[model samples]
Target: MTFNLLLSLSIALTLVAAAPGPGVIMTVTRTLQFGLTAGLLVVAGIVAMDLVVLMATLAGLNLLTLANQPGLLTLLMVIASLVLIVLGIQSWRRPIILRLDEGHASVSHFMAGIAVSLTNPVLFYLAFLPVFIDLDALTLHDQIVLLALISGVLTLVLGAYALLAAKLKTWLFEQHPERQLWLNRISATVLFILAITLIHSTIS
Candidate 1:
């Protein structure tokens, strides 16, 4: 990718990833509950979902196609909204904790992250893959380069969040065990709002 293209992509991706959304909330929750290691695993899951969405979009299974389909987009929005609501309610009802005896930290955290990340369609439409589509003028090699840079920057930015979460985990656990629940509610709220907005946009 050209430097300018790479620079633009980096800036855009940073802003998108840095935004307070479901992924960010998940990372923070994981960090507070488990630690940096678990949070990083969540980040990996989010990135993996991004790659999947990108590939799907590139292969013609895009949001636009769903939007064009009569009820598909609306259904997706409804399902996503419901998932967020359930997650929010669940978070509100439970204390977020790290069960050290449950299983291997890495596997458990990664699996949870992957599951949570896959539930949000907005991540694909709002975040990473859009950058690739938007920069379609670039050659394949340049596109790959740009994607790599974007992913690398995202990893760093997200990893930093995980580290911060790990550092603050003790404080969060001690002072406010309910902090994770609050974060979950906030994340769910955002997701719910996005779902409604998406449905409205699709129908209009």
Candidate 2:
């Protein structure tokens, strides 16, 4: 949990949060339908689940660290790097279309947010975390700070998305497909860079 690691995670998470996805689309669609508060609820739900996923990942990472098997850890890191690279390529090749499904009337917007998060999940962010977080050196204070970073960054970034979903819905998603394409590329670029950085760190 070095400052550089936190900073890199913050920047990378910001970009990932801002990228187009089911979560973003839900925020936009719900905001357009129910209003800003509704959108924030959605963000809240997503953030809640994100923290859950992070905690679970941290638990598994702790077990890996405690095993004291550097070779196994290194192998996993290599695998994770390859996965990130493949994800980058797939995202770069994918196209985004703006279509809003009429959400279930019985489900609350907050619940819908949780469902979207669960459905698409945080595999991308999960891959990004172990690359930067050194479990061997992680103190309790560092763990607290790390959790704070994840929650705070997500809240600020996704909250901003919810705040702007109304304005951006038409201009960004609906009208200019190119703009969305660039966003997708940005996410892809981040993924590729993370993969390379992880490989370098593991070997070095």
Candidate 3:
């Protein structure tokens, strides 16, 4: 049962990671602007926050279930949708400027990553985590293992996105400056689509 639960959770996390969200956008932005190193730093910050949230959820902040808090999930969906739309618009309007300087901004990149992830309620739904398995049925050891596996899977998924963006930075953007702007527009469009989807889900 424990193994089954782990597998289920891993699949769910993979799907979630693949979905366009703040963390993915942050990773793409950092990679496009700074390079692979900065992108990795942003991913580290995101994963750190995700672990913190998971720990909180395991510690009984199972707010994701919305069992106790009426309308909380809907509220989160609405807020997240609005935020995504704003982010998308902002990205669409921002000029594509590449800053590969290595002197500073690493800390800011990391913190921005964390802040983006934490603010995205769509990513770490407190109710979503507990839906895969019965937390009460699991022993403390089981819970720890589940969380650890989740963290690992999350890192791999987000890391893949970072690497892909970094590769594109050199392969496409370096050769053609306009490519970055197009990429930014594409990312922004994805964000808008995600926001629309969330809103529809909330209403439906």
Candidate 4:
């Protein structure tokens, strides 16, 4: 990848990653509930999903193809919506209890993060957009390098956000747990709305 190409990809990835979506909400909630370690694990899962989506898009399974397979896309989106709704409701009901003694690090928590990340369609869409935009111009070696660079940038951006959320957990919970609940609810509502919009768009 040329410098210009890399710079463009980095800028695009940064903007996409910075956008507040289901992944962001999940990372924040996991960080608050389980700590930074868990949030990072979720970040890993998200990155993995991005890789899969990007690869698929590069292989010509573009958004248009997905749109054409409305039955599959609709099913996936509905499943994802249900997962987001359940997660949001659970986060609202349960207060985050920090276990300082045991330390907040576990494979299970990391896996949970991955599961949450995999369930969100918005992440797939974001990953697909960049692949659609950049894949055709690069040679095979450059494509591999570009994919690695993009993935690395995304991982770093997401990890930073997860770490920031973990760092802010104390202040966030202390100030108002109810506020976090409200935020989770709002995030969940947005997720559902997006899911509906995607379905409608696909069908139309």
- Return the top candidate by TM-score: 4
TM-scores for candidates 1 onward, in order:
0.65, 0.57, 0.67, 0.71
Local lDDT at 29 for model 3: 72
1-204: candidate 4 lDDT, tens digit per residue: 668767876788788788887567767666766677778877887787667666766666656566566566556555654554555455556553433322456665454444455445533554555563555665778768767976798788878888888778767766566565665555456545544554454455
| Lowest lDDT block of 10, candidate 3 | 96-105
Candidate 1 all-Cα RMSD:
4.8
Ranking by TM-score: 4, 3, 1, 2
Q: How does model 4 fare in lDDT?
A: 0.63
lDDT of 1 by residue, 1-204 (tens): 557756776788889788876678778875665567778888887787666566555445666666567774457545545554555455455556544222136665565455455555533554554554563454677546755775687688888888887777676556666566676566556545544554465465
Using lDDT as the measure, the top candidate is 3
Q: What is the lDDT of residue 164 in candidate 4?
A: 87
Task: Give the better candidate number (2 or 4) by lDDT.
Answer: 2
Per residue, candidate 2 scores C-alpha lDDT tens digits across 1-204 of 667877898898888788887667656555654456777887887778677666766665553342244775466556656756765686588676456332233235566566456444234455677677765467778877877887898788777877786565555556655665676677567657656766775665
Q: What do the candidate models score in CA lDDT, each in turn?
A: 0.63, 0.65, 0.70, 0.63
* For model 1, the run of ten residues with the poorest summed lDDT: 95-104
Clashes of 1: 0
lDDT of 3 by residue, 58-172 (tens): 6776554552345865675566667667767866886855543332446755765665664566335455865777766767888778778877887898899988987777767
Q: Model 4: which ten-residue window has the lowest total lDDT?
A: 95-104
